[model samples]
Target: MKLSVVDTERCIGCQSCMFACSRLMGKAGLSRTCIRVRSAGGMERGFVVIVCRACEDPPCAKVCPSGALKAKKGKGVRVDLTKCIGCGNCQDACTIGAIFWDDEADKPMICIHCGYCIKYCPHGVLELAKLEAGHAKR
Candidate 1:
């Protein structure tokens, strides 16, 4: 699977995706949201949508000292909270800066690629794409 940036120009920077993620996890506030939306430069320069790209070999999982992260092919990695030691290696390994943090829990927040945030993206800036066979490295 793929989560594509349909059009960054259309983004309104409303932070709807962040709220959607929190809501999907049955929570309130953005402290634990997986997706992040921030201004590119300033309000007039538009915004940037930060989320997981579902890498073939997710470095996040590779750097997990506790084996808490599991890469699921093109679906992104699953975080086993029980196995997670609240280490920050996975967060640093993500080149795209998709990994988020929960200050209260001291654990990294990651996207499950559930597409929950897509519906709330009013500008149509994001869309999930299907990955072809062999699209990801084995």
Candidate 2:
């Protein structure tokens, strides 16, 4: 599926997306979220939403020594925690800074592309698009 593209221009740096993601997993705060919204050189420049783009060829998956990362139909790369080794290779592989670290578990926090974060974006910065048939390459 299409990644919920973020329009940097529209971002208010509210970090609602980050809160929403963590809450989806029954967590209480931003520390556990796969998505991150932080100020870019102070809030006046606005915020940046760090999340997966559902790459056609995900480097994170290729670098995973344990095969913890898997590409899925209509979604994107989802991490298999059991297989993950907490190597942080995916974190380094991601150019967008989408992969987050759960310091408590010492593992990368990955996005499942569920669109839950979109609902919490007050500035209309994120939107999900459908993946066309045969669009996935990896």
Candidate 3:
């Protein structure tokens, strides 16, 4: 399954999804969240939900010099922490800025498409979708 933002217009910028994601990772703040909700300048513009679109061929994996970021068939990349060199290549390669940095661990936080954060999105802005025949619904 892949996580997608279906309705950005519905977002109230409550940040409940971000909090839930962080908590699931055994943390207590935004530092560990794979998802982010940021204001689109002001209240009139709603907000933007930044997250992985789960590319079939993720650029982040391609730039990882240590091979720590391995591309999944259709769900993006999985991290092998033991092989990660903290070079920041994966983070820099993510065009959408979905890859988050763990300042303390000096590692990147890639979404696993676990759908844990979806449960907390009060606005129904996020969805866990099943890809069909190499295509995903945005």
Give the top-scoring candidate (lDDT). Answer: 3
Q: lDDT of each model, Cα atoms only?
A: 0.85, 0.81, 0.88
Query: Across residues 4-109, which tens digit of lDDT does each residue of candidate 2 receive?
Result: 7648779977788888989998899877798787888888887767777777778889899999999776677888999999989989988878888999989988
lDDT value for model 1 = 0.85
lDDT of 1 by residue, 64-131 (tens): 99889999978889999899999799999899899998888898888887887999998798888886
Best candidate according to TM-score = 3
* lDDT for each residue of candidate 3 in 1-138, tens digit (9 for 90 to 100): 788889999998889999999999999988899988888898688988899888877899999999899987657689999999999998889998999989999999989998999898887999988876766556
Instruction: Give all candidate RMSDs, comma-separated.
Output: 2.3, 2.6, 1.1
Question: Which regions of candidate 1 are displaced past 4 Å?
Answer: 133-138
**What lDDT score is found at residue 98 in candidate 1?**
92
TM-scores of all candidate predictions against the true structure: 0.92, 0.88, 0.95
Q: Candidate 3, 105: how far from true, in Å?
A: 0.4
Candidate 2 C-alpha error for residue 23, in Å: 0.6
Question: What residue pairs are clashing in model 3?
Answer: none
